[model samples]
Target: MNESSSRRLELVPGGVQLGTGPWQRPTSPSWVLVLPQTVGLCSSDLKEVRRSRDVRSDFGHEMVGLVHSSSMDDFPPGLRVCLDPHVPVTRTTAFSETTLLEGSPDQLRAALPTVLDGTPDDRAAFTEPLACAVNCAGKVLAGSDVAIVGAGTAGVLLAVLLRLKGCQVTLVNRSPERLTALSSTALLREVPKVLISEVGTRTFSTVVVTTASLDDTTFDGAWRLLSRTGGRLVLFGGIRSDWRVPGTHVLLDGIRRGEDVRELELGGRRALVVGTHGATGADFAAAGAVLAAPLPWTAGHIEELIVGRVTLPGLAALLNDAVRTGVDPIGKHMVDIGLNQ
Candidate 1:
């Protein structure tokens, strides 16, 4: 086999740039070389590009790759794996065609090898985002009544994962097209789907706001869906820094202080608001298991959510378009490296 050159997304002046360079392997004995097969372009990635001014290439984390070579015996070459992006080496550096992962055996243990043997690379790439949903699911009690606002990728995954866990979940979104997309899967077909205008007189034990760009009206709507006595509002999708939510800054401030739960007043009703971001190593492992295991909805779960696929250069084009229009496409867009070669 020949050594591979690396191509990655770089934050440049005016917009994003496709950067090329020689792929370097770590001299350390524990390092592993990975050839990324499929990478998901997360909303967080676009946000990072939109916010930063420096020229940087370390961005793009959701990936499924094959271990091209490994110094450690545990991770043999050719093993399919999903990387944990929280680690320094893999964080925001997954856009490349090749990646060199370096860490202690325990640290590198996050490179979980449980994407089912015959699963398509694209389907397996769902691990990272699913891990995030697993982390959020941990907050709610088992079988709790839940409402998820925003029917985007994260929101839809959250609904499916929570419903499988025995929670009564209602998926609420303003867009019927997105909701219609969910109906294709039999599992999601059972979950109650409601539009924002129709979500009246219904309250949940926990309400999760999964809209990437949250506004005041959505925030208020989420509050209304929460039970007045002890309902919990989860900020799963982040709020724009420039946007303000009335009566919610105090809760946001408390969350920044490391408080897991904060008491707040919404619509004159007292409620608890909690925030969740990213995923843990254990969550990553669990996500891998969920994908690999045989389940009724596993196929649909992995396949239905992907709305579009692009190559590395095509990804740059999408990012450029987002920069120009100030709007991103409504669904998940994957960067398939095979499309490039």
Candidate 2:
């Protein structure tokens, strides 16, 4: 196969720097080269890029593209597909939209339905994050009162997904604009929106700290917002410190960024990180099917949540905010690789 080249989203000190690079296909059978049609922006993409502006990050998971080539029979040229970067075979960096993506056959087999049917390319682009929404929110049972902190893409997504499961959600964030975006969303229109100040006085059975930015205060606040002795707190975006939860909280399962929380002697409360378990082929398949026929909010939610569409060269300002640490970035921002170029 001839070597391919494409634009890369290089993380610089303040924002993203775009440059061209060769798209090399590794000598792995499960991997296939894909040219993304549309890549959905994720808050996690911001976190990884913002991990250090000095570093480069290609962290795009939400995209739908055509298979450029594949050694595997299941994935062939002209086949339309999405990616699951968490699949062990797909753990490389920077494979979102507009660039050449190395995809996973296991993910194709397990996650998506046959032939990217029904959904449009733009709507189908939500496959990966919707899969993530399923992974995180599917854990909570119906009828639970849930509080999702951060109001970013993931947090907003969790709100929609959890509500689909019959849970009542209270979406909280510090940014009024982000809250405004939520209020206008097709899926979250009925779900209540609350400022951070409003949550301390109330409680929930499950609290998903799915925020991509501002991990500290929300982390402590989410713990306080969780109600009942056995309530669950699932941290998806991750926390920085080892802050202790004095009483009535217990570490159930997940990655621990806390000190004494890991050694707690409690019996009822459950606090664990949902992302601790890596994405599997099953996850990918379920994600694909969900996008094809997403229930409750469905693919229509993708239409309402998509705030902007920009080509590679025009992504500077949006991506800069995307990677900003504390600033809450709005809904899904897609990158059009301008493949026609």
Q: Taking the candidates one at a time, how many backbone clashes does each contain?
A: 1, 5
Q: Cα lDDT for residue 130, model 1? A: 87
Candidate lDDT scores, in order, read 0.75, 0.62
TM-score of model 2 (CA atoms)? 0.78
Query: Across residues 224-305, which tens digit of lDDT does each residue of candidate 2 receive?
Result: 7765466776656544433334453433322432211232223343443333223455555665665566556444645567
Give a tens-digit lDDT track for model 1, residues 1-341: 23656787777866789988777658666788777888888877787778742223336767888777777887787788877766544333667777777877777876554466766777688888888889888877789999999888788778878877889999999869878877776647788888988988988999988887677788888888888888888878766544555854453523522427777876767877887877888887777677765556544556567789888889899998998898877778888874245
Residue 331 lDDT (model 2): 62
* TM-score of candidate 1 against the unseen true structure: 0.87
Candidate 2 residue pairs in backbone clash: 12-53, 58-94, 110-285, 111-284, 111-285
